[model samples]
Target chain A: NAGVTQTPKFRVLKTGQSMTLLCAQDMNHEYMYWYRQDPGMGLRLIHYSVGEGTTAKGEVPDGYNVSRLKKQNFLLGLESAAPSQTSVYFCASSPRGGVGQPQHFGDGTRLSIL
Target chain B: GESVGLHLPTLSVQEGDNSIINCAYSNSASDYFIWYKQESGKGPQFIIDIRSNMDKRQGQRVTVLLNKTVKHLSLQIAATQPGDSAVYFCAENGASGGSNYKLTFGKGTLLTVNP
Candidate 1:
C-alpha cells in the first residue's frame, strides 16, 4: 500500500504566485499534518486536521491554509507565495492522535518561490 | 520555549562499527519519543520509539534509549552499514495532554557510514 503520497513533487513559482500541495493517504488515518522543512532547521508544523472537515492552526500557520474535505486527503494552499515560502513541504498522517502513535510521511513537495 | 536538539550535526562511522546518535529534549512533559531515518529524496521512516516509563526499546538492528532524568534520548545501531547512512531525527510528543499527536523534532544528525 502506498502509505502517503504527495503530488507535484517539484514546483517553481515567482513571488506572489499561488499553489496548492495535495497529500493523500490510504491508511485511513484520523490525523493529518502539513509541515515545512528548511536547511539546518527541523520540520515546523504549518497546519493540521484532527478529522475530516476540521482544521487547525499549527506552530507556523502564517501564509498557509489547509483543508481536509475528505477522509483521505489533506490540502495545503499558499495564497501568496513568497521567497521565504520556498521550502520542502511534507504531509503526514497517523491512525490516531495519541501517545505512541507514529506518523507516516510522504516524500514531500519541493517548492521554490523566486 | 521547549525544544528538541541533537548533540551533533553530523556523524561518520566505519562500516561494521556500532553507531550512537544522541538527542536532548527540553520539555519534561514529553512522554513519547521516536526516531526516524530519512534517506536522500525520501520521507522520514520510523526507526523505533520509546515511552517515558521505559528506559530502552529495541527493534531489529536499532535500539532507542530514553533517559527522562536528563531529558536525553539516543539511538544505537549495531554493525552499521552503508545502507544505514542517512539523516536521523529524534522527536518528542510535547503536547501538554496525552496523545495530541503533535511532535517536536530535532534538527537531525546526518550519519555517514564509510566502508
Candidate 2:
C-alpha cells in the first residue's frame, strides 16, 4: 500500500502566483501535517489536521492555508507565492497524535518560487 | 519558542565503525523524542524514539539515548556502512499539561560513511 503520496513532485512559481499542494495517504490515519524543509534547516510544521473537516495552525502557518475535506486528503494552499516560500514541502500522517505514534512522510514536493 | 539543535553539523565515519550523532533540546517539559534519517531526495524516516520516562531505546542497528537532566539526546549507529550515510534529525514533542503533541526538529547532522 502507498503509505503517503504528494502530487506535483516539483513545481516552479512566480511571485504573486497561487498554487495548491495535494497530499494523500492510503493508511487511515487520523492526523495529517504539512511541513517545509529548507537547506540546512529542519522540518517546520506549517499546518495540520487532526481529522476530517478539522484544521489547526502549526509553527509556521503564515503564507499558507490548509483544508481537510476528506479523511485521507490534506491540501496546502499558497495564496500568493513569495521567494521566501521556496522550499521542499512534505506531507505526513500518523494513526494518532501521542507519544508512541510516529509520523509517516511522503517523498516530498520540491517547490521553487522565483 | 522552544528549539531543538544538533551539536555537530557534520560527521564522518569509516565503514564497519560506529557513528554517534548528538542533539540538544531546550524544552524541559518535552515528553517524547525521536530520531529520523533522511537520505537525498527523500523524506525523513523514523529510526528510533524514546519517552521522557525512558533513558534509552534500541532498534535493529540504531540506539537512542536521552539525558533529561541535560536535555540532551544521542543516536548511535552500530557497524556503520556506506548505506548509513545520510542526514539525521532529532525531534522533541512537548506536553504542556494538555493534549499538545507538536514536534520540534533539530537542524540535523550529516553523516558520511566512507568505505
Candidate 3:
C-alpha cells in the first residue's frame, strides 16, 4: 500500500511563480501535515489538518496555504514562491491528530525557486 | 550531570561496531518520544519510540532510551553496518490542550559506518 504519496517529486520555478504540492494517503489516517526541511535544520511544520475540511497553521506557515477537502488528500499551495521557500517539502499522515502517533511520510518533493 | 543538548551532530564508526546517537529535548511535559532515520533523498523512517514512563524500547537492531529527568533521548545501533549510515532524528510529542498533536524534531545527527 502507498502509505503516503507526494506529487511532483521534483520541480523548478522562478521567483513569484505559484505551485501546488499534493499529498495522498491510503491508510485512511485522520491527521495530515506539511513540513519543510533545510540543510542542518530539522523538519519544521508548515501546515496541518486534523481531519477532512480542516486546516491549521504550523510553526512555519507564512507564504503557504493548505486545504483538506477530502480525507485522502491534502494540498499545499504557494501563492508566490520565493528563493527562501525552495526547500524540500514533505507530507506526512498519522492515525491520530496527536504528535505522539507515528507518522508515515512521503519520499519528499524537491523544489527550487530561482 | 545533565547534558544541555546533543554532544555530537555527526558520528562515525567502523562496521560491526556499536553506535550511539544522543538528543536533548526542551520540554518537560512531553510524554512520547520517537526516533527516525533518514537516508539520502528519502523520507524519515520510524526506528523506535519510548514513552515518558518507559526508559527503553527495542526494535530489531535499534534501541531507544529516554531520560525524562534530563529531557534526553538516545538511539543505540548494535553491530552497525553500512546500511545504518544516515541521519537520525529525535522527536517529542506534545499537545497544548488542542485536538491536533504535533511533533517537534531536533537537528538530526549524521551517522556514518565505515568498513
Grade the docking of candidate 1: medium
Compare candidates 1 and 3 on lDDT and give the better one.
Answer: 1
Best by DockQ: 1
lDDT by residue for model 3 over A1-114, one digit each (tens)? 889999999999999999999999999999999999988677899999989999999999999999999999999999999999989999999999554588889999999999
Lowest lDDT 10-residue stretch of candidate 1 chain A: A95-104
Per-model DockQ against the true two-chain complex: 0.68, 0.63, 0.61
Worst 10 residues of 1 chain B by lDDT: B1-10
Residue pairs of candidate 2 with colliding backbone atoms? none
Q: Write the per-residue lDDT of candidate 3 for residues B1-115, one digit (tens) a residue.
A: 1122333378989999999988888878877878889999999988887878899888899888888787788889999999999988888776456632688888788899999
The models' CA-based lDDT, in order, is 0.90, 0.90, 0.87
Q: Write the per-residue lDDT of candidate 1 for residues B32-70, one digit (tens) a residue.
A: 888999999988998998888899999999998888888
- lDDT tens digits by residue: candidate 2, B32-63: 88888899999888889899999998899899
Model 2 regions more than 4 Å off: B1-3, B6-8
Off by over 4 Å in 1: B1-8
- Higher-scoring candidate on TM-score, 1 or 3: 1
Number of the predicted model whose TM-score against the real structure is largest: 1
Candidate 1 residue-wise lDDT, A40-64, digit = tens: 7899999999999999999999999
